[model samples]
Target: MSDLAALYSEIEQKTSTFCTTYSIACAQGCGTCCEHFMPDITASEARLVGAYLLFIKKDFSLIEKVRQSIGNQEGPCPLYRFDSPFHCSVYPARPLICRLFGACAYQGKNGFAVFRRCKYNEEKTMPEHIDFHSEVPVMQDYSYLLRSLDDQEGEVGFLPEKVASMLDQLQFLAVMLDMDDTNPDDTPNPMAS
Candidate 1:
């Protein structure tokens, strides 16, 4: 879990720098992306989100929302909160794809990094397109970083299904492993092999 935390931190820093350097930004208070997008996430990502929901946010209703959303491959992410200012209920624990959605570049067929405005960027705050000749934070690079931290060889499922499944498994372990007395920070990482 510490590995993931470190990886996430590195990703945040890199993406922030990349976006800033490119003058790319998302529209303020607009969550149209999460509104219709469902991310595919690795098991390690699911475990982090599940643990955050259960132990940190203590939001069982959100957990129930995720449970109810299983097999939904077209709808909005279960963690999206329409009424919240932050929008994503599990923002800090969101998966790698979520973090990289509008912030990073992708390896292009021309062997360079490319970034384009998100489809949801109707406000068009970001640049329409940018090609990077120098090295940039390419999505594939971060994909590998996330996979290296994943215990399951980076098997991915839609966010709702993965997080729901993780919640069920983590719950079973919590009870059997008697984790009630442990602080959230002290709890054993379910994502660890």
Candidate 2:
């Protein structure tokens, strides 16, 4: 749990730095990105989310909610729970992918610019005073930082089912083990495995 808390703190700092650099005003009670689906969580993140749910004893409710939500759709997301005022219940332990969202992007060698916008800002146009193209930093750079977080083989992609069951529990243990293996540096590593 301490490792998970530290991980949240680390990412929170990164996200705060990002918002500061771009002058983005994203805060709790802001609930802008909470309404949509987060499609790119790593296995480690999924596990943390699951642990949060289980720790809160919302596991069965989360599972049932996810099941109901994915009737025709797909759901590898066990932390895809509901909350009031448009927020995720398991937000604290949500994946790094979710943290890296909003400003994250991907570019092709052919110079195709791809933007990943949060659902919160999708239809709601930016205020008339803002210049989104020039003012905000692209999400691509943040993604590079996230890529360095994992010790997996290949690019990390979202696979909720792979992490939806017992596997998620394992990731929680992995995060704890990681903390145990590290020396007490200012910046703690969340997982050893």
Candidate 3:
């Protein structure tokens, strides 16, 4: 398998394990975190999402929606269809950042802090809430694994964008998947990458 494919598999596996352990009810219709800015994902993530869309034969329409969703709002995500709150048009193909929510971490005094909940989650209670932050595994470790696949020389900041931009840059199917990983500058991007 390609490096991109391996990264996707690892991410999916880790995300599934984390969600299951937390009993996270992230089924269709739950657009809580989706409302926020789309997370900045690595080029490999974009490739996987694009591939999944191609696998389902929904690339065109989904990309179109992503394109339209750009610059719409910082609140409700464009991929979220308000009329039908039960499905994400690109659920399986959603970006790695989207998959990382609630299970990922933020740097802190201690190595990294697990993002245990979201605004919606704090207001709502569920049986699965078992204080996983104190014990459960996290997505950060998997992120380390992805970095191992490539040097990823420096710190890459976050930038939310329509899925179209990701797909366009991915160029996975035919365009060619190329990356510039030698640069080691840790500069923060003023806008979303």
For TM-score, candidate 1 versus 3, the one ahead is 1
Q: Alpha-carbon error at 122 in model 1, in Å? A: 1.4
Could you give candidate 3's per-residue lDDT for residues 47-114 as a string of tens digits? 55555554454445655666666665464555556667764556665655566666544444466444
* Shift of residue 161 alpha carbon in model 1, Å: 1.5
lDDT of every model, 2 decimals: 0.85, 0.49, 0.52
Clashing pairs in 2: 76-160, 76-161, 103-139, 104-139, 105-139, 178-191, 178-192
After superposing candidate 3, which stretches have Cα over 4 Å from the reference? Answer: 11-28, 59-61, 70-75, 104-108, 112-115, 126-135, 148-193
lDDT of 2 by residue, 1-193 (tens): 4454565576677667655654445444555444444356555555566555544544555555543443322433445434455455666666665665664334535555444444566443322123334323335654555555644632555435534653345435645666332222223445422
Which portions of model 2 show Cα errors greater than 4 Å?
Answer: 1-8, 26-34, 67-83, 103-138, 141-159, 167-193
Per-model TM-score versus the true fold: 0.89, 0.54, 0.59
Better of 2 and 3 by lDDT: 3
- The candidate scoring highest on TM-score is 1
- Candidate 1 has which clashing residue pairs, if any? none
Better-scoring candidate (TM-score), 2 or 3: 3
